[model samples]
Structures are given as structure tokens and as C-alpha cells.
Target chain A: MLPDATLADYALRLGDDSLVLGQRLSEWCGHAPMLEIDLALSNIALDLIGQASHFLKFAGRAEGRGRDADSFAFRRDALDFRNCLLVEQPNGDFAQTMARQFLFSNWQELLFAQLQHSANDTLADIARKAVKEVAYHAHFANEWMVRLGDGTEESRARTIAGLEWMWRFTGELFERDPALKPLVDAGVAVDVPSLRPDWEDRISRTLAEARLELPKPRRWVMGGRVGHHSEHLGHLLSEMQFLQRAYPGAMW
Target chain B: MNAELPLKDRVLEILSQVADPEIPCVSVVDLGIVRDVRDGKVFITPTYTGCPATAVIEAAIGKALKDAGFALKVATMLSPPWTTDWISDSGREKLRAYGIAPPDRGTAKHSLRDVPVECPRCGSRHTEEISRFGSTPCKSLHRCLDCREPFDRFKCH
Candidate 1:
């Protein structure tokens, strides 16, 4: 039997992925280059953040920790977060950000599809409801990827570079850690190892359609599942945690 | 069999009375906010997040469910995120009458993505965007030259 701590940690890991990416997307709330795109990004951000809150709160309960979502979000240090490397990479230029979004949303779409059938009813419930929305997001980003790639020389260069920069983080999407073992065994989580082949095939095809290439394989960065993260996470956590850290349990 | 009553049926009928706070002519169910009724719980999700009007809608749903004789635990779902696609045609009409334009076909013209939006109020194909962000997050600020009136356009998101 795995420890409750492991399950709780895993829950936070999932929650953190949502939270951190949610925060990144929220940065575009009013700042998107296009108005509709602004609403689109904000809507996606809101969904991700909301999902994180639910999972984090559930995680707190499972851990028997006397904490809520806000506390978990605001109080965590960098070392405690467990989101994948792909989501936390900085949103670069529009093409870069779009490319990053394109890759992450595709991976997330596949992840949530299998997640929807999870044996753990809560995770399944979240996944089933989220699949439709993520599908839209994935489609939206992909459309732009294709447009930007085929449109002009500048747009093509930016898209290609953006995808390459983001490629290293792709490896983490399929990683397995101690915490996911139980959920995977229970058939309540997508076996990360199983998703890679299809994820690769689709990404490869999507890039080819856009006239982009699969980035050359480099040393893949791993271990975000166990709390090791890039430097960017600390700054993100600081911003996210600031308000709640300053004012505990505040609600208007 | 009592032709007069089944507890759940009567209960749902009463609960269905909750009207959307944004567009009162239609019930929240018509807006697709109320997804399910099970074990005396009302499961609901907003058509959009940060909508500002969601609190009032939830309160109304709560009151409606209670008034209907069922204790309700209203759950908010975020997956399968809400899109403009979910807005019923009737809800779109409610939006038009409420002074917002119904969503136009090809909200994004990959071809003319930069072109002017047609005004819903005046039917002027000659309209200009005043602000990308509108009076609310869901709307975009637009003005029609023909009517020379400013109005909100339901963004194509």
C-alpha cells in the first residue's frame, strides 16, 4: 500500500500543473494581441485555474492536511511544485507562445481523454468535463500554428524556433513517478508511458502540416514530478502566492 | 400508482424555475448551465468564467432549488469549457434584445481577420472596434457608423 502522503503529493502535482499553466495563461488576460484571443486565453486560464483549485482542495482532503486550495497555492515554495516542464516555459513572442500553447494543449488533450475514464470518480469527473474545452484550445492553437507557419517568412521562422525551444520539455509529459503508480494501477490515471507514441505521432504530423520539423533530440530534462523545476517556477509561484500569502483566506 | 405525483418529477419542475440572471427570459437550464439533477443536487457551470454575474446566478439557482423542495449542492464544472457555441439560438436572441449583437458567422476571418466587424444594432457592415475588451469580458466594444451608436458585440471566442 502506498502512503497517503504519496497520493496527496500526486494530487498537488496534478493541481500544480493546472495552477502554474493557469497562471501563465492568465498573464495574457488583457494582454493578448487580439481581443477575441484575449477572451479566449482568459477563458482557458480560468478553466485551468478552477480545475487546479478543485484538485488541490481534493488533494488537501486526501492528505488529511488542514489546508485549502489558496493555502496550497500561496504557501508552496518552488521545491514543492510538480507541474511538467512544458507548461512553465516562458510565453515568448506571439509565435513562440502560440507554438508553446500548441504543443502543451495537444499533450493535455490526450492526457485528459484517458483521464476521463479514470477509476477514481473525482479525477474522471474532472477529465470528462474538461476534454471538450481543451479540445477547443488545442484546435485554436493548432490553427494558428498552421497559419503562422505557412503565411510569411518571419512568422515561419518564429514558429519553428518556438517549437524547438519547447521541444525539450516534451519528454516530461510521459514520465512516471512514485505517486502516479497507485492511480495508474487503479486505472484512475492515464499511464504516462502509454501516451508517448500517439502524442509523438500527432505532434510530428501537426508539425509536418505546418512545415515545421521535430526538434533534434537533446538531453531531456526530467523530474518535475518529484519537485525539481526550472528557475522560472519560483518567480511564477511568488506572483501567484503573493496575494494569498499576504492576506490569508480572503474572499470578496 | 398516484397519477398526481412522483417526488423527483415535481421537484425538478419546481427547480427548473431558476432564471438566468443575465437573460431572465430564459431559465438557466436553457442556457446550459444546469447540466444535471441527481440525488437532490444541482450541478451547474457558468457559460463563462470571471463573468461577474455568476454569483447572482448561483444564488438564484440555490433559491430555486430550495423553493422546489430539494436541498441542493450546486457544483461548478470547468472541463468541457464553455464556448459561444453553447449559447442557444434563443439565448442569442435574448442577447440581441438585451442590446448585444448575435454572434456572426465567421467571427474570425482567417482571410479578413483584420476587417471591421458588422454592427448588430444598425446592420451596418461598416463598424469599428472601440476596444478589444468590452463592457464585460464576453463582449467587444464596437460602434456602427450608420446608426452612429456604440454597442457590445458578443465576441466569437
Candidate 2:
């Protein structure tokens, strides 16, 4: 049997990725360039948050803890967060946001597609629904990538810069954590490393259509799966967790 | 008449009166939100994983059932995942009448063909998508070229 602790840890990692990314995207809610863009980003953020709730709720159950999704989301310190380094990076500009979305959503869609077949019923169920949502996210981001990469000279430059800023983090998405080996062996979790080839193909094809050169990857960054994160996540958590922290079980 | 029917049928009848919070033209049944009812429980699924209206819909359903004197617990089922194909034909017509383009049947195939959405207002085939994300998560914004009217389409999931 796949250990409950392992399952809880894995679910927390997945949940944290969605939660942190949702928080990052929500920052665009009132700040996007146009009203339509603002709504689009917020809608996506809502979806991510929704997905995060499911994962965290399941994580709590697996851990056999009295804590719920809110506890995992609002109580955990940054060192306990297990999201990848890619999602926590600041959304620099329109181009950077789209680049982050494009890279992350492409990998996420692929991961969820495979995860739908997981032996764990809850994870599989969540993945089945999430794969559909992530498909739309990927499509949305890919459209923007092409538009920005092939648009005005200034837009193309920005798009290139955006990809360059986020490329190093891409490698960590496929990293096979040793702790997850038992789950992978038991078919309770996805073999994340197996998802890389398809991710690369789709990204390469999209980049080609955008007339943008593939970024020359720099030194790959890792450790988010092990709870190591950039400085930005602490600030994000403070803002997101403020309500629950201040009120102590505050409810509307 | 509802009282004369079987318990499940009566419960379903009551639920059919509960309108979707966002799209008032359609009921929970019309949208395929109610999956099944058995063993004093109503199995429901949300149209979108992240739709904020999910809790509202569930609460409303629970209230409607309770008010009708049916003792049942609302349960959410995620397996077999909800799809736009589940929306009833009557639901599609109601959506069209309400000015939102109903999703085209067989979304998987339609999406690949890059099918242009027919405008709910003018029936124009020359509609272009304005934004993939709309005011709601389940919709996409589209503009009719002929009428120049922006409308929402219940996007194919």
C-alpha cells in the first residue's frame, strides 16, 4: 500500500503549486492592462484556487488530520510549501505572465492528463476534471504567446525576455522526487519525468509557430518539492493568509 | 402531482425548479449538475472545477429539498467528470433564448475543427472570440462580426 504520509506529502505539493500560482494570478485581477484581460486572469486564478482546494482537502484527509484545506492553505509557513519555483516568480509584465502561464500550463496539462489514470481514486477524479480546465488554460496562454511573440518588435522582445526569465524553472517540473517513488511504483501517482518529452514537443511546436527561438536553458533550479522556495512566496502567503490569521476562523 | 410520484422522481422534480445561479434560464437538471439520487442522497457535480457558484448551487439544492420535506444529504461526485455534453437539449435552447450561445455538441471534435460560434443574437456565423475567459469561468467572450454585439458562449469543456 502507498503510505498515507507519502500520499499527503505528494498531494500537498500539488496543492501548493496550484495555490501559489492562483495567488500570483489573482494579483493581476485589478491590475491587468485591460478589463477583458483582468477578467481573464481572475477567472484563471479562480480555477486554480478551486483546484488547490480539492488537492488540499484530499491531503488533509490522507494525513488523517483534523486540519482542513484552509489550515493547509492559511497556516503553513513558506518552508512547508511544496510548489515548484516556476509559479512563485513575480509576474513581471504581460509578456512574462503569459510566458509563465504558457510554460506552466503546458506541463500541468500533460501531468494532469496522465494523473487521471492514477490508482488513487481521489487524485484520479481530481485530475480528470482538472485536465479539462488546464487544457483551456494552455490554449489561452499559447494564443497569447503567439500574438506577443509575432506581434510588434517591442512585443517580440518582451516575449523573448519573458521566456528567458522563466526557462530555468522548467526543468524542475519534471524532476522525479525520491520520496514519490513508492507512489509511482504503486500507480498512486504519476511518473512526472515521463511527461517531459510530450511537454517539450508541444512547447517547441508552439514556440516555432510564434517565430520565437527556444530559450537556451540556464542552470536549472530545484527544491520547491522539498519545500525550498524563493523569497516571493513568503510575501504572497502573508497577504493570502492574512484574513484567516487575523480573525482566527473568520467566515463570511 | 409531485407528491403522487416516487420519492426520487419527486426529489428530481423539486430540483428541476432550482435555477443555476449564474445562468438563471437553466435549472440544475437542465445543466446536468444533478448526477443521480439514491439511498437518500443526491449525487451532484459542478460544471467547472473552480466555478464559485458550486457551493451556492449545492446550498440552494439542499434548501430546496429540505423545504420540500425531503430528508437527503447532498453529495458531490467527481468521477466520470462533468462535461458540456451533459447539458440537456432544452437547456441549450433556453441558453440560446437567454442570449448566450449554447455549447456545440461534441466539443472535442468541434474544438479541433475551429468551428465559429453562431451568434445567439443575430445568428451570424462570422463571430470571433474576444477572449477565451469571460465574466464567468464557464463562458468565453465572443463578438458577432455582422451585428457587432459582444456575447458570452458557454464554452465547450
Using lDDT as the measure, which candidate wins?
A: 2
lDDT (10s digit) by residue, model 1, range A77-193: 888887888788888888888888888888888988898887776677677656655666687788788889987999999898898888888788887766667767878667887
Write candidate 2's Cα lDDT for A208-232 as tens digits. Answer: 9999999996799888998888998
lDDT of 2 by residue, B1-157 (tens): 4468887788889999999999999999999999998988999998888899999999999999999888999999998888889999999999999999999987843542457999999999999988888989988889999999999999887
Worst 10 residues of 2 chain B by lDDT: B106-115
lDDT of each: 0.74, 0.91
Model 1, C-alpha of A27: deviation from truth (Å): 1.1
- Candidate 1: tens digits of C-alpha lDDT, residues B1-157: 2338775455446644777665566567556676666775666776554465677888887877676556667777655555565566876777777777756544522311446766667667788877554545456677888899888877665
Candidate 2 deviant stretches above 4 angstroms: A1-3, B108-113
